[model samples]
Target: MALTLTCERQGGNYGPACAFSEILALAERRWHEWFSQAPAMGGPYRDQYYYAWWVLANNLVAPFGQLRHEALVPSKKQYIGVWNW
Candidate 1:
């Protein structure tokens, strides 16, 4: 079984259409560009290091409403609020 899910802001115009493969390729390219800047970690913990960075990036939210700066939420599913500390 396979399933694909997408989300867009309510009331926002649907942007340009893209095939699933194209969308996946774009996401992969963007992830590579972002991950390329991550500091190198060589050891058994390397995978954990990258996973932590991925989690942060995945939960990052752009400034919106009262949020004046880009912020990272604790977790998109469990916690939707940002911390100042």
Candidate 2:
């Protein structure tokens, strides 16, 4: 829905090639074993099936934090949840 449109509106999509690169990096980084900071998500043979859905999150773009990229931009408004997505 919004993602399909948002990708288009952002000048252009990240592209299949770039996207594949990201996937490969995810594999090389062993995200299948440990995807996030949550210890529950980490394991020796974590199925990681549900982890795929994490991409649907606005987790990448932000002054807010998620996963590895942690940074905060001060502002009066508050982002309580994924509502910003």
Candidate 3:
């Protein structure tokens, strides 16, 4: 996933092989976790889509540009959801 994001930024060059870095591994873990917890909003993975955007915004886009995109605030749906929030 990390490799895909960077390669996309580079316009599909896919130059170097992605190293098995800890951060990349963590990102993958979080992605899976988000999918697992998606049932909180709806069973068809509706909530997961929001979190995927959150991951791109918070973890990838903002950090890459070194600018504040927005606060990493969880929406009310998260904490108040029926599933594990």
lDDT: which candidate is best? 1
Q: Flag clash pairs in model 3.
A: none
Please give, for residues 1-85, the per-residue lDDT of candidate 1 as tens digits. Answer: 9976453455766676667887788789989998999998999999999998898889777653667777778775877578654
Error of 3 at 73 (Å): 17
TM-score of 2: 0.21
Tens digit per residue, CA lDDT, model 2, 10-80: 54455544465665676656555444544554465455644543442324345423534543333324654
Candidate 2 deviant stretches above 4 angstroms: 1-30, 33-36, 41-58, 62-85
Q: What does candidate 3's lDDT look like per residue over 1-85, in tens digits?
A: 3534342335546566556585488678877785666444657776677767665445332334444453343444454322221
Leading candidate by TM-score = 1
The model with the greater TM-score, 1 or 3, is: 1
User: Candidate 2: worst 10 consecutive residues by lDDT?
Assistant: 3-12
Candidate 1: regions farther than 4 A off: 1-16, 63-69, 83-85
Ten-residue region with minimum lDDT total, candidate 1: 4-13
Residue clash pairs of candidate 2: none
Error of 2 at 81 (Å): 12
Q: Residue 43 deviation, candidate 2, in Å?
A: 15
Tell how far residue 80 is off in model 2, in angstroms: 14
Candidate 3 TM-score over all chains jointly: 0.28
